[model samples]
Target chain A: MSEIHALSAGLALDASVIGGKAHGLVALMRLGLPVPPGFVIPTAACRVFLETGGLPGGELAGAVRELEAVTGRRFGDPARPLLVSVRSGAAVSMPGMMDTLLNVSSTGDLRAAVREVFASWTAPRAVTYRELHDIPHDQGTAVVVQAMVLGDRDDHSGSGVAFSRDPSTGERRPYGDVLFRSQGDAVVSGTVPTLPLDALATREPAVWVGLMDALDRVERHFRDVCHVEFTVESGRLWLLQVRPGGLSGRAAVRVAVDLVDEGLIDRATAVRRITPGHLRAAAVPRIRAAAPPLPSPDPASQDSATWDRAGSGSAMQAFPGSDPPSTGSSRPVTEVGSAASSGLEILARGRGAGPGVATGRVAVTADGAVRMAAAGPVILVRPHTSPLDLHGLAAAAGIVTTTGGLTSHAAVVARSMGKPAVVGATGLTVRTHDVVVNGRSIPDGAAADADADADADHMATDGHSTSEGTTGNDQTATDGRSTPEGTTGNNQTATDGRTTLGITATDTDQVVMDGWSIPEGTVITIDGTGGEIVLGVAETAAGDTGPHVDRLLRWAAEESVA
Target chain B: MTDLTVLHTLRCMGFTDLGRVASAAGLAPEEAESRLIDLAVEGLVTRVPGAFGGWGLTEAGKAEDARLAAEELDKAGARAAVTSAYTDFMVLNPELLDLSTAWHLRTVDGVAAVNDHTDAAYDARVLARFADLDRRVSPVCAALTAALPRFGSYRRRLSAALARGDLAETTESYHNVWFQLHEDLLVTLGIPR
Candidate 1:
């Protein structure tokens, strides 16, 4: 039986038997990647247990004995006891669709613990998810039980997640988040602000090296962008889960072509992998250059900092000239006073949906969002939004929610509002008073200024893809709200005209033609697909089909070595 | 309850002016106006002084209403019953929200695109979902009425609002009685909005 297979290097378990996550982990292990030791109880056992009105007597007891024998520890023992994470994994990927309990002290209560995990497959939220995703309801979940590697075990211990490749730009580099002394859920939860995966080098060199090598091997084996959830315990690394084919848009196109060029997969498979939906998603507009010009205050009476932070431009792209430091170990430059602010941190990198970063002050509460309409632009932050938050929904510049799936209240509302949003940031526990991102605790009051910096960076970098801020002389002042520092980078289209005082920007900021100055009163067209700030509301372009995206498609058209 | 006090309840009910809140509270307009004046002194309620304006709660009035409503639920010893009803309400809350979202926006090919209102069939499907949710919510309304007689008014107002396509009253539609029910639940539970 699939249940009897040891979750080791060569266990012949199907997705149906071990669930998708454990199956993928086993695949990685087979491919010689670093995966933690774990075993999966097949969905059949779950079915039998539920049918018989509790766990079958011998199966669970036998498994527990085996676990004790293998790990050389008893469950829930005070002295050197073993703890495990029990999670539900369906044959299909039903992310967050079932219950997951972390840090369960495995003991005589192991059966009860397993039952709890199994029962979660039927929660209202999970049921709704299945209904929307078209997954069958009767198909139960397989349980993956693994020895808990405490990410918070010591200073040297922490948690992180990594993609075998940059899922955003389809760059051939490992990308993810790393938090020292945290748990696997900690990284997924967004409870602690996470450093870039590269930070692992400075923090834990051996772990970082192992991770990078493992990532490389996994990428080669999967021949596609793969993501791994992992944790480190007292300097030792452990892999929790793995998956492939979770990319979309430009990144997807790029990977398809690049894999063929690397002789991994052939062009036909690449073509087959990309659907029309992928093409459509890729063409969504984004902010062109990081750091766009700020608008003049309507009244000087407004809190300068609130307005400064609240300014729509605060979420602008990163300035074009900035480059991501090459070393994996560069520490964050703590800008004076910036340490207190909750500026933007790149959480989990994904293919930029629609581009063009615009930042506004973070609005934590629904009431705060409604009151913000008259004040300035605001980004709505919530544990998850409900219908009651409609007034705030109507007024937000963007949306960031800590919980729910992709089709959640926050995501739907953000799409309706035509705002940039990131959802399913599991670890974000934002209250009316404070918010958490990447494990960093940020007071609500400090979030405003940080929002401004984020906006400036967002406008400049276009989703942190390029560190280079605003580029060269192509800058054309849009509304004559120009800053003296506006240096245009290569091939930039800036709307800023230097009619005002002190402002500075690095060279290479792109400056484009003044199509029509989008003044405060002048309602201009914003193409979420093209990242274009245009003259008037125009018909949606058939498609931009930009050269950058086209190059990716061209590569996908080639033959694969695999 | 005092006649004047019942009249003032109509004032906060809005639009139908003094009569609606008064009738719902089982009072007369003159009596309600007298109570409204007393409330006005406290700056709890106000008159709009226009053809469109009638009686409405000021910020303080809204707070007072919430406090008083919660006290009423507690004093009646119906807090447990109301709380149970509220839990049931929470279950149906998202379906209502989803219907509202679908009404405002349309999803095509898994990507939620703006609902330009081009597709009649899609709109119908969403409305059907709203209808389904409303049916589900009826039981909660009945339970609330069972807990407290005053809550009976919500059932009438909500159904009337839905029948009239008042939009807000239906689910997420503006006239949505659901919003009022939500407000009432919060007030009953002593939970802040």
Candidate 2:
């Protein structure tokens, strides 16, 4: 029971003993997909360690010997060292709440790492997470000590997150982020910018083919959509983690309907997959998305150096002459009426923490956001956030920050406060009232310069509110103030008479945060769910769900008999 | 020196009515008003006249509070201890927000629906966890109190909020008080928002 077991398809063990993560790995190996050879020190051992504060010792040595024999590597040898990552996983998933130590080689390192993982189940954060989620605190997590297969081993090596279907729209395509020449932690940390997942096809064809086959097998096995974390080492692909069917809302409907269409699952099962909650979430309004315009030839953008970096998809998309985004929620070859011909340009992309859209003038500093918000809707854009920025965040229509992940302070606060936010746009830089993204600066102030003074005066007098921000290009003086509502449209016209794209606010139920250098007074729309910040009211927001979503709705209606 | 009690109370509470400021400061309305008036006269405070009117710190007032708080921190020589306590509070910060969010929205079967608080057992569970969290938070509060006496008010306020049994739906609820305390620590330590 306390003895570590080798991870293989044949070794049947309860999740309580080996944990869900190791169980998933075993299933992947069973499906004839690649998983690294490793061993699991069981949850029973964790209970023992927690009680006595030490491992049984000899069992771990035996497990290491088995791993060494399987992988043909020496542990702690300077010439041909074998490394392991010690992680804590429970019967139920407790993602990222506990500690993990990677690249442990020495015996001391291994013991310390294992001890840390065992102890980490009771980490205050983990305890708090359990308290919120109603997971029992007493269940000690199983420790997974496995051989470290390097993701950053070579040019052909990288790590990625892949969904069997698009998570955003539930379309039948693999979608997620990929980081070349980086480890799994880099992708999780979100500190390193990641390329789109499709880059794998061109970079490593064999790995891509292997991944697709694995995705198909896993989906067929689970009879639903699945997501996996994978790493490739020197052209060899390996699956690290797998989970099935966490799709939600409209995406949930689309998946259920599509799976039925693909004959992977029956219609009754599709109906069962949806609950009343899915219907309600599907009803939430979204920002209509349009493909952002390629950046016009700016000298800095013309330089190949920026796009030369391996799979800089965002940067490549920024160039107007370059190819449209082939991956992500943005359509490559499949979707229709989603393309941008109206000259709307995307300045940056980040994690959408909040689920609605809003548009406003970009305010770089908290003081600026606080002051500027009085005049018009202001999107507070910062490098990162601190408690000092609360007043500014409170005042702003939406929030955008250059750094921090979905769980970062800015993201957490924004979601709790119910403001649409996009965080962790790595290349974003703010200067005064304008934001520069990927070396292509969106001079927000410059576009509004013609009327900056007047707008500032209007803001000071009228006090922009939610009601005032949503008035279309024509509505005026609703707040009983002389602030000109009709004048904002003037910023949309350039000297050449080609319409300069700017975000325009309209009365709608969706939440959008726009900081993409639209003219300060120009209204814009955003889809917080899709992490899309676009200029102008996206014409395609809610009125169009297409044939796929419509079929789901019809099927759901038939199923509920409600 | 400067009325640190009233100023710091307003600082933590955001824009609010005189009643909350007075109650939070452990003072009567009249006493709180007098202090606010004095602070207003010194250009450290201002009142907005509207349907949602309240007295709030002006730019000058916020600066003065920051300056006074920093000076007070140094004067008490409790910087290190207060910082240590702040670290502990930070570890509890996300959990605090999680509880608050759960109180507002229930994630059922992978969907987030507004929590009606109709389920007595669920509410009880949330409140019990809040109590557990409070027990863990007590030492952090005590450490802050050891460093700065002014921080003792937060301990009292938090305990009182818990006694009142507010999980959600109150501006001065336990969650809100804890939020303010979190903000106060950040502001007191001259940390960013």
Candidate 3:
């Protein structure tokens, strides 16, 4: 049997044979979308290569000849070279754990790239990801070789990933990041800041319109919210990939309901789509400010002392009673409203990997975290975590990494420990003794000793003895009873109460540097449910699913009655 | 050079107790303690006194360990071989971490809940995968041992952890041992963690 198959509308094969990516490309072709022309080397070919460690030499050369003819350019012909991207695509999506080589022009390099992509299926990270996700070990990945559509071809060129609806909030709007005059890899790496997807509308209007149309058509075709990776080569749009339905939790529910409202899917289908896991995740407590921003607290009256006292009082009142049993649907809005009134300014945002709320001081290193934990609760902030940081993870009240998604090691460990974690906060940078968030540098340890001492003096005048003014020393007093006034009485579980109070009491350092820098000892509350990192302590309210979930469930009930 | 076995072992294991440092170094606790005391007197290591405290390398100890590790690699003429083995080790590193994380957390009903180890079948599946990974990693360990004999201790400790079913959580678990081996590779290759 032939090991190669052209990725076209007429190609009919199971994902097991062609791999999910090839299958999706064929689907996009079938929908009349502008998918870059490509061909797939089936998984069986990879299996053979794995067994014999040799490519089907004649067949690969013949396939290249056919691709050259189709693209009207010769391979390795520098005058009009036909470069292709060689990518790994298993039946299952093992995102970011496999290899992909781009801009290969020579036949030898192309063959080598294809071999590498096939071999990446068993790459240790890929193997572990498969093992964790229950993907079969023996099902080797297929190789997809597509003619390159260079996003860096011109000023009008760009690459981006777009969701048909907002992946975070499930709003019916295109949401994604775009990098102009760069390849898709640059966009995915998060090394360079990207403009909003709307930037394409102004710069390359035709490509933007085409992308929107493609998104609409795919959503209709799949009957679900879709994510697409697209590239514009000199203003001509080419879709590199498309996948349906990876929206999770609240976003998933919102998309399902929105789809029903749009007549793309029925209510029964919407009900069937959301699982118990989605319901559970949707019910996790989120900071009230994560939704539409509450009116900013009046800056003129926002004195640190007054704000702390007011915030403390409101937090206690926010959770006056035991948490109401979660029903996976609506909750009383009054609780959320009361918590939202605290008016905490958000420092940064990222994907919520763990569920709950945690407030603590930031520690840039694991050892720093361990040292800081003795004085008060600490949040271990790192560029990324390794096994070496395990101890720091253990000692921290919560965790934050400037990079990595929910499936990253730091996120997994945070969830394992039941600690609130925010990951992929790309705007944050970790340094040796400090962290820079956005443009503000927040010093830690010895760098912040001067500020801590000054804050201690400020606290003394207020008659609060929470600050020891000796943050530089390892022998900072651990007296829990000296908790700062108006920082206690929150309904945090008894197990967390001591650390929570300790963190709040010790975070007496006033924000310096034009109220931009939040020093190491400064208090910050993180909402793992909503991915919000807020300055100061903010009360968490159980994620209010708004009306979409209630409406979807109501439809399900009606469908069952019928 | 003075024997840096216990010191190097402690350096890789991060902060840990004497028992674990001894076990990883393939020495008795008393022998490890003697070495540790000797090293501490030189201001290379320190014993932290607290609930979370243990014996850890001081800044000077870490620098000394790195210098010694590089010296050992060069003296043995195993830099190229060890570097190649380190490359192979990195491929298995992520899988080990994934397994460790899986042992600690499982997705039930789509939410990441703590594994709790109640579901025997789930635990068995994870353990089986660990064993499978261990089998695959044997060659990499073998390559490393051939390059440097001290690397053999990792192979022994990893198998022991698997045999004892201490996959994660414990200080002597397979995850911890694997983690130390990763650190050793970086230290030997002069690669930054």
Candidate 4:
């Protein structure tokens, strides 16, 4: 068979031939790991499609013909149909930057679909992403046409993504969100809220067992913490894609060290793998515990339930201030007493880039945020923050963005500003009156409550009345700030009455401050390096957590033994 | 029946000084202020004190607006058209925000820096995008106005904001107008912030 037609065991082809995503898939296949049955249309075809202003005739036809021949189902047949996911896999992963059509129903239009996917490789948005990321424009994408594995096939079926370990803490165990009776796109799009990966153990024990076995095989094959996108159909497990080496910081360090200990790689190679970028990334604070709080039974845990209730509380209390009375936790509760006040909210889940959770009134606009510094601690939520958001960013206690990745502008700014940040949270809406938190709606200006009032009061008594925390220029409303800042900046000045300092507690662990009793589930972080409040303490010190990190390192080492 | 002349028009005006509110509601300032004071008496609206303050709807005012807007939408039977228009509004919303961000910040050496208003060329590029986005938004606004005549003021006010933005330095410029329009959508759709 011609090299292009070969389905397996072919030498590594350039991304141009197999496309970036499929090329990686082929590499995994070469390593003897399970991959869903699939085929690729070379970038040469895409280049031709773009130049000729349509799909190159014979290449797409040939590729589709081969796909149907292998899948044993007619394309777009409706019954026993061969559905496929057409993805834009450029050399660099520009997630959500390009278009991906899933469960495409037409096999006859497969060629046109491939061309469409190719054309999207240079859509205005995609072009802009490439410019922002400094990715060269001319390197066209290769299209991957894979026979779709139905994640929602039956009771035993579902779709999910799993990292051989926790990507957040680099702890070894299958870690990722899973949605029953859904497809890969649903998991990635985050439109449908997902359940904890552990739910699979009870919901579909057989599938969960199969998934663990597959993970073990893939981890042993990659000799690294590998992330997989998979689906189970009618009790059958199918792996769609596998990737290695996305862990960063402490997780990366721990993974590398463990790999050496397991004899999968030498100590020198492990040392080499810990790049300076990884070290710098590691230095960014994270939730210290490796294992996420065992997915709690709080109603907030269900993604759909939370989304259906989207924006309900943003107006009344968008901030859910870090120390606000816990709505769902077993803690002293304070009735905010107004329908206008949005109850506490879960902003979407990401890799937890920074190690803390905070609550502050959300500032949707940069100007509004600039003005907000005096009123209260503001959480700057945006589709994504640019250089313009810096003023708001400077004033915000936390930042949440709907667009961009770890390397996006918002993440960089949040890190630079030394604020708690969550980025790449999909389905985010930042309207003037409300902002969507984790798919839930919250009313605007609803966060002006007793908590913020107290924070304002606390700041004033501490003499940072200059700071103006959200009580609207009234120096007297600075009631809460004094209590929250008791052991830190506020108390230090209270006793001496001569301290010229502003914001006394700079320590990361002490971000909750000494006297302010932290409510259960409120995220807090302390920067060990700059002594600044990072996010939640869980996030800031995540790397130091033993269970999640140590377990991952140990697992990677054990996999290497196999 | 819903009052197109009253609630729907004010929904898009947001918190504004008397003159702008009156202009948005197509009433004289004295007339608009009288109605506003009456609404304030009902606890549906309030006149904020000081230079930075303005006439703003209370939480009750927002609820009332949402209830009345939905009724007006149903009365005119413009829900589908308005919903479609709202989707179109959503499309334009992001572009508007991008323009706003560009007005405030710029990029250099892969770093986001303040726009500083020194770069006329960059400012013009962003403004051009805004203009493009505005052109696309016109049809949707027109559709909305056709469904309810009260929405006609948005076309005028939006154009006014853009024109001022193009001609001179105005702090409450195009972005501010767009922000109000966005607020108008949430109120109209009864989607909380």
Weakest ten-residue segment in model 4 chain A by summed lDDT: A322-331
How would the candidate models be sorted by DockQ, starting from the highest? 2, 3, 1, 4
Candidate 1, which segments miss by more than 4 Å at Cα?
A: A1-4, A50-54, A106-108, A186-192, A290-542, A552-562, B1-41, B45-62, B88-139, B149-171, B174-184
The local lDDT score (0 to 100) that residue B28 gets in candidate 3 is: 90
lDDT of 2 by residue, A174-292 (tens): 87667777788755644344566777888898899999999999999989888788889899998888877766666677778778867888777888887767666665555543443
Error of 4 at A36 (Å): 2.8
Model 3 C-alpha RMSD vs. true structure (Å) is 10.6
- Expressed as tens digits, the lDDT of each residue in A199-261 for candidate 3 is 788888888899999989999999997777888999899988887875556667777887887
Tell me the tens digit of each residue's lDDT in model 1 across B1-193. Answer: 3222443243233223566556556567676667767777887665644323355555566556666776677788999999999999887776565555456544344333445668876666655555666777788888889988877877776666566655332222333446556766775687644
Q: Compute the TM-score of each model's chain A versus the native chain A and list the values.
A: 0.65, 0.75, 0.72, 0.60
Ordered list by TM-score, greatest first: 3, 2, 1, 4
C-alpha lDDT of all candidate models, in order:
0.52, 0.64, 0.67, 0.51
User: What interface RMSD does each of the candidate structures achieve?
Assistant: 11.1, 8.2, 9.0, 11.8
RMSD of each: 12.9, 10.5, 10.6, 13.8
Ranking by lDDT: 3, 2, 1, 4
Candidate 1 lDDT for residue A555: 48
In each prediction, how many residue pairs overlap at the backbone (N, C-alpha, C within less than 3 A)?
A: 103, 20, 0, 65
Segments of candidate 3 deviating more than 4 angstroms: A10-17, A43-63, A115-141, A187-195, A199-206, A290-344, A351-353, A386-391, A404-409, A412-416, A439-516, A529-531, A543-545, B1-3, B26-34, B105-118
